[model samples]
Target: MAGRGDHTTVPGQFPAQGLRAVLGGWSGAGTKPRNDDAISGRIPETAYEMQVKGAIACIADGISTGLNSDKAAQISVVQFARDYYSAPESWPVRDCAGRLLNSLNSWLHAQNRSGSPDAEGMVTTFTAAIARSTTLHIVHIGDTRCQRLRAGRLVPLTEDHSARFMGGSESLTRALGAEADIRVDYAQETMAEGDLYILTTDGVHDTLGEAGMRDRLAGLPQESREDLEAASRALCQAALEAGSSDNVSCMLLKILALPSETLPEAHRRLTAQVIPPAMKPGNRIDGWEVLEVMHSSTRSNVYLVRRAGEDGRFVLKAPSQNFAENLQYLEGFTLEQWVGRRITNSQVMKIRPHEDSRFLYYIADFVEGETLRDWMKAHPKPSIAEIIPVLASLISAVRVFHRLGMVHRDLKPENVIIAEDGTAKIIDFGSVQVSGFRDLERGDKEELPEGSLNYIAPEVLTGQGAQPLSDLFSVAAITWEMLAGRVPFDLEERTALPSRPADWAAGDFAALRPDLPPATGEVLSRALAFSPKDRPEVMSEFLGEMRKLQGRAGTRPVFVPLLQRGSRGFWRGWALAATAVAAALAVALVALLP
Candidate 1:
């Protein structure tokens, strides 16, 4: 522990997401002749940088094989700290850190290959901890350690990358620059205020055994910043006293504060934004001229709009005036734009938020093309060659939503635009099911399912939550319509499907599309399975089967025969029953007339 007179101030501060962190560390060579270990960290002073880049701390240990081993250690830790912050703010912590480490590893490997005199091969063990937005991201390699000290209880957070060989010599199994390509280990954990993290080189941990270290880490009160530093210094010194042979290094990080508002509370604030007035072609709002009213309905209005002095065209979408006060509608509208902006793809619409415009409106690219619905109208029998690639792009877009724990429950030709370049872009996120947002949106109950019945999965009629397979089913329906010009079974607009599974199976799509290759139509038919479990488990499987159908005319797919359609005459029985009911209704009407 530090003496009362030794009140060492921290080097810097990094604040973000309504939270504050106090970082401290101490290092030494211990009994070793010279130190070959390094510790470094960077905390951004600006909120934008802090929220995007967050705070990063790392430790590196050099192998004794090279004479200038310390240089490798120093460069690894210091460069990681610097380069991590300089990365683009739009990237997530995991992506930014992973990419930088990969680049750094390649550079270090190149240095080793150069074979220069007096130059130690640039290879070292690396471990980094990133604190960002109520979460902690861990990027690790080699045998260094990272742990969380929460509620005075030590929580081990990393697995050491070391193995014992046949000769009983322990060696690092993974380390940056150890080979031409490195596999970085990554992990994540949610964070809270009063949380503390401890980073240590193997020298410190190997000497201070588990029980000894656990006892020392327990009961670290938030007495003062010096106390935290004192704990770190004591841990390092204790390892030296225990006869550690290598250089010892340790870093301590404390979460002094965390954001008070829940995610739901922050989301509601977005809904409180001002609603825009009704728009017209000649009217200008927020400095953007409305060129044309593209589409409008009970839900929202979309307009072709542009800002003066801007070279590119844009589309503006706003909630319907009547639904301005509807909280669910507002949340859906906000979420549509939110999801649009987060996703990165040319096939997915890009939503640009207007910082100055308080009105509830968002601008996106004015893509030049027709909706897949309209395009299908023009090309009813689109060649398999044309539709396959376009549909593949659309499936890829849906996969992005799946990766983010969301489901596009309502997928149809109307919601997809076939761009002039033939790329497919999905739009209208009103029916996107965000699995992560359920807790935040629990208060806003949906009275009914929010999708067009023509494309909705049969299981949805049984009041089941929308699953990714449900979206795949909708995708199959749209593909079917493009080729066959109709759904498997005729449906009234937005009408409820038969509740029974038996009735659903009776709609044999094979009977109507006999011209299509049995294998091709067979694969698409799997997507229309009444039970999600019976469908392709993933979109990739669906796409793979579709790809296999290309250029193979003789391959007969596993055909599930139209069950009980011949002798039993299911449709004929249904028609007869319907006619009988109609006659009874007529007789009752005549009696009433008399």
Candidate 2:
């Protein structure tokens, strides 16, 4: 008494034209009285979502021994596909899927614990495949499986979690509600245009086997969605006809195309606007009038602007025409706007949306403040007490970027703005590195480091990519300059940039400021280590050490003798003493003569 339960086909429609695939799913009960299997999937309607979160296909199989196994299977598959698309687009696909699966497992376990006694609780096996960009990300638990067929070769992508007992009996070693805590397997595979992926439950895979499934899939057309649907139904039917006594399910996804692996492709897909030419005062574009040319450089231009019929002012930034054809620079410019719009911290500048604009530029909130460079110039050789508050604010700002999976690769005095109330806001997103963007990139080409030479981390200079530790290094360099009136490394004095990590050495902070506690120098030294591994494991650790130094500054003595302080202090002290001795000798000679 075999019967089909549910069947669906998610149409292959990519309006913006990227990552196209065709999906079909079918489920049925072979001989069991009730079918406790579920299948679900989603293809986003928007191209932005496709590029960021991608499409998902999931299947779950409930244990027949459980009373509410059907409910468990349905809930797991449906909830996972729905919730995964709702996650932040900035998160890496692996992180988003891992977190959702963990949460889903916990909720299923809780339902089992709260169920009525005298009946087995809900339990099921789960497996999912996410097609993002040019790769397939797989997450799995229990015996539910995902496999790929490429170039006529069928490859298993997931391992079953069931174990055979001594007497030939089998039991699941892992499932969604089998335990309070779950450990799921994760893997990735590079996808090709003609690749076909299959997802199945043990009912289908164990009964038909890979050989039988391949036999059923042989001669299936690649482009016809109807043919893929027929193949999915055939696989389940073949499994049941082969003497399967349980629920059978099968899902098919065929990759028809992948996104282009180039910066120009990304630019075209992201925006259709043209880069605005160099702007000056009185220039108007997209209803915003440029009141002043704030700053202009070969890379970009910043202007103070005001929109028509608005009293508030804004800062508009545009990429320079010099790099109009530079795809990498244009991509970074677009990413800067994307990052700004997503972040909502007071310490980070906010991007105002202008969806109707025809030019490539972003408008940001204008904060009235002086650059940290100007502040440093005004308070040359600022005391440790004076620097602690500013440093704390700067660190707070940086933590926001880190929490959002970003690294501000360039952190220097000029990039920070200090308000009259001592609030520090980090600016300049040109060099920020985003984990999400890295996941989307296809190539692994190395490029020169992206920050001012003195402030960039030593590891980055040597071709190591920027990380949170790299940002910490830049912050420490800025802090060192504020306290000692000089950078930690004299990068300007070098004939050329350091080609190796060993060539870059941090200058001696203790030698310049002996009045501060020795621990202060130790903290800065650790932050500016030549290797990222040698630095504090996280930004919080570096901040903790800085706070400790700040706490000790009150009790610590700063009245060291001038000779031990520094060269300038020692020479000034000597000059004052010599002048006093000369005055004393003149008085003595005058009295003796009189």
Candidate 3:
């Protein structure tokens, strides 16, 4: 049997229109007694879902030796695609697919072990391609393969996990339900216009070969859905005629168009509501009454407000009317709402729904706390013990963003709120860098570094782009300030800011906090390194070191042997000794001559 279809995002649905593509698939029993091959694909209907999850296409081929191989293949393809979409949107594509595949494999493995007599067990090869924004994410296992057709050339994207014996017979070394623990191959590629992703089982590709497949695809009209479907069927048919007996399946996803701004459509959606003018307390707009102005700035205004009949207090953040015409700023302001709505964590501020509002603003849960800057002021010289808990909470919160493929580009003391109970909540999404959103953007626009000079990563200043390591740099700076009562680098004192990564240097932590252990300074120094490569790769590693530092207490100053000290200290001591010896030898020589 052969099957095919297509999916396209509804027009004019999102402020920034999302990924667009065409999907088609075909499967056949070939010369086999029964088809154990299955193919499935999904493209979300809503713009939000389309942007977050994008689309997924899967193909699975069951082992002929298994009693329920057909059922296993069907479950693998259908359930894998269904479960992928059901995963949390906040998760990165790799995380979503990896976690789902692991769980699915475990369940299938358990089912196989519990089967009755006469059941040989269930096993199948699986491969899937996920297209989100402008990236293609691939996950593969066993002999099923994923390939890309770009610029009229076929490119293999996955390697077969099979082993061949002396007589040329082959068997899968890895497959779903074949083992208790599964190792999946995952990779990603930048998607381009007119790219066609192909997924096929061994029955099709092993027979047709890459050359044959490429020639067939080259002959088809790439853009037309009908032609794409016809090509899928044709590939399976050709494979069957060329010889051998096994189930044949193929799936094709063509990139119809990459995301580009439909300006009129985007402008209409983004500017649906007028930017509200500045207002003081007692002002009313959009059902919510302003109680007090929480913050005001040239970029945005944050107001503390409450609904007419509700006792709950909320914070309403509105972009400055001055930027009403600044589409980029407006888009970022809108993205704040999008990000806040998707992230559901107590450590991160939550954006509440206000469907009836008529103004261009978003309401979030009002956190009762002082800014971390103020917290630092109250404890100018806090011990490592006092700072560890706060750092722990902050690290946990930042990891949440990292896991979601987001970098809080503007992490600073003012951006973190320390509640009365000591919990921390990260705020201000104005400068967040989201991986998915980056793909939606139309062009590269040069912009200044987002965070404060003292806290922003050195690499970001040099246009290396915001990353998880950048956030780590900011956190380390904050921690240094908490202990030393000053930023690691007095950025304000410099005549000119560092324009390159090599020019940036962190102040000596040992000089500032000599009373603490040497390891303490070493830890902070590494985290505050000018090169991100010099820092810990993950937050957990950095946090683990901090935790170790917390257990050590302030020790009385002790004299150290020159050899035991740093290279600089050891070399300086040797130079002083040599100077004394030369002076003594010169005096002795003068006395002997006289």
Who wins the TM-score comparison?
A: 2
lDDT of 1 by residue, 165-225 (tens): 9989789898877788989999999898888888888888888866677777676544344
Q: List, residue by residue over 461-551, the lDDT tens digit for candidate 3.
A: 7676878999999999999898888888777677887776556666667777877766887898899888888999988898899888877
Model 3 clashing residue pairs (backbone)? none
Residue ranges of candidate 3 with Cα displaced over 4 Å = 1-18, 110-120, 147-159, 180-183, 187-196, 208-231, 241-244, 262-272, 325-328, 356-358, 446-449, 492-495, 499-503, 510-519, 537-544, 547-594
Using all chains and alpha carbons, the TM-scores for the candidates as numbered come to 0.72, 0.88, 0.81
How close to the true structure is residue 57 of candidate 2, measured as C-alpha lDDT?
83
Local distance difference test, each candidate: 0.75, 0.82, 0.81
Name the TM-score of candidate 2. 0.88
Worst 10-residue lDDT window for candidate 2 reads 1-10
- Which ten contiguous residues of candidate 3 have the minimum total lDDT? 4-13
**Ranked candidates (lDDT, high to low):** 2, 3, 1
Residue pairs with clashing backbones, model 2: none
Residue pairs in candidate 1 whose N, alpha carbon or C atoms collide under 3 angstroms:
none
